[model samples]
Target: MLIKSVFIILLVGLFCQTSYAKDNCPTRKPVICYWASWAVYRPGQGAHKIENIDPSYCTHIIYTFAGIDMDGKLTSLDNHNDIVNGGYKKIVALKESNPCLKVMLAIGGWNEGSEKYSLLAETEESRKKFAEDVSRLMINYGFDGFDVDWEYPTQRGGIPADKENFVALLRALKERLKPRNRILSIAVSASVAVSKQAYDIEAICREIDFVSLMGYDMQATNATSIHSPLKLESSDPDDRETLDQIVYYYKSQGCPTQKIILGVPAYGRSFTLQNPQNNHVGAAVLGVGREGTFTREAGFLGYNEICDLKRTRSDWRNEYLERNAAVYGSINKLWVSYDDPKTIVAKAQYVLEENLGGMMIWSIDTDDFKGRCGQSAYPLLQAINKGLGNQLPSSFSHVDF
Candidate 1:
């Protein structure tokens, strides 16, 4: 009896140690951030470049974008200037600052539409040629991988054949990239309608390294509601979107938890409230919100401008909705909904609880790149990193990538 009791005690100790190790392990998932090349030309609000980026913030950076040429080949979108002026080389050089940082070229954005991709994926010949071109581009540009940003597969001016053709394109690219050990990833929509009608989740999971889920933009210009709620609030309608629902939908469709990256926005959706007194979640809106100082967009505000507004405007008051795990502010008729550091931390906690791969920011340029927000530079990113246990070293600048 004495020997048996000792054996049981040892077993319990072993179990506790194993549990602690599993709980405290470093995050093995990738925190991906997208960097827009065109932001360099956006005057005051959009003057961001590869050099402005903090190498420690993200595990992977995707340069957006390289367009599809007339002959279905990968081509530089910036008037061919990015290629000639060594912009691609500058992006690749970032690895010198953070060797663990993987750089990828993202092809096709919303502006590129689905027409070109539909045609490119229609035939085996086109898919093969496109894959070869992408592989060649990666080799020449020193990119670690490529990400496909197809807006939608079966819909969005695409044919029914796109469902299978999309898979074929991924397969072709994977096969071509396998020898070089390069990664292949894709950006997917989080809309329930598109999610159900579009992606072949299981097949895609089988072919790609990871899926960057565009989980924001749930609320469009036409509606005034929470843009990216962690969960639906009481005031939210039945059809209202939430990040939890988006994540679950993908997981249920057979996407592995570790292969999914939750995308967060570094911007906000603004709405011009019809009645200043009725400033609430489902208030009536009068068209888009007023244009922002830097973004110069009617319904959008970057984190920098948003923080500036909260700081300067007397009417602006921050409101944290606990149930929804979202933050928003109102100043009379002007209301802006965005994720603050606290909300980001909560979402990052959600990422860990769900055992997700990691979080992805839409465009790091939209972040408080100048560190004027007072919570340290990249406050939103810092919260995420801390929540995921991937904190940046206090003296990270000492080491080159």
Candidate 2:
């Protein structure tokens, strides 16, 4: 009788342990969303606030970006918005609605440049100081982790030693964050040429939670082309790089497939054709396309801006680069290449087929969150969520256009 009782207790304990492990482990792939703080400044319909974000749309939200000072310490670039006005506090509060959602603070961006990050990573003392400063800021602000967006470690005015030092910097940050159960991730360029010069792929992969591959903005030359293509388009040169080639290159370099998060753009790159009739890809371009009313930046248009153009105008011709898995629009002299819901779904399916970690949106702010284009709100993100085999929560199940 005593032996039987002991056996039963052991069996129960084993079952409980197994159940606990299964329950704690993440069952679905992550949907990482980046929220740009600057979107608050956009006028009228283009302005995106912290409240506009749907917590259900993302598994992880990264706030970009917190700047690094000359002293190698983490600092808020926009104090009035980020700290004084409770931007960080409000974004972190999203966890109340999404218990599984992880929020991280990103440091460095294209505007911040690479030289500052290079100098910061050049010494152990600076790296240690930066890591500690990051930890304190995260702890105080309730951020779950840190995201390093150094652009490219060894280029953009950065030194050659940045290749090894980049890995060292991540190691230091990882060591500091691990004890607190926090995470660390990086955003890396997708270009093979750039990756070769900037990263020690295998080493960097081993240290961080995942690599966010900037799969967009990879136009080969000044010629008008699809900014982000899943595969080489029929019109593309044989040597032109695509998202497919980018993934294969990273994997061949020893980065695990599951550790790579494919980036999807929520904006489009635009070019002004020299002749309105010559609006196809590889056509001649005189300069950047005209800016949007809200975004007000030449050569770029938010998905919201693009969709507005499509909705209000009747003359624009839209085409899907079927072979490449991308889409484009041309009206008069304006040519813009961007991803729509259909293409976003295609990318998400590719994510599952390739066993990638997840999808990372360059930003959620640029998406048509208000549903002004006569489609469901967050159509692109919704496509990604559903394509990844997950359903929207009961609260947001009723999508509005």
* lDDT (C-alpha) at residue 196 in model 1: 74
Clash counts for all predictions:
3, 0
Best-fitting candidate, scored by TM-score:
2
**Over the stretch 295-396, how does candidate 1's per-residue lDDT look in tens digits?**
788989888889988778887888888767788888988888888788888888899999999999887888888888675788887877887878564433
* lDDT accuracy of residue 327 in candidate 2: 94
- lDDT of predicted model 1: 0.84
lDDT of 2: 0.89
lDDT of 1 at 390: 85
Model 2 misplaced regions, further than 4 Å: 1-26, 396-401
CA lDDT, every prediction? 0.84, 0.89
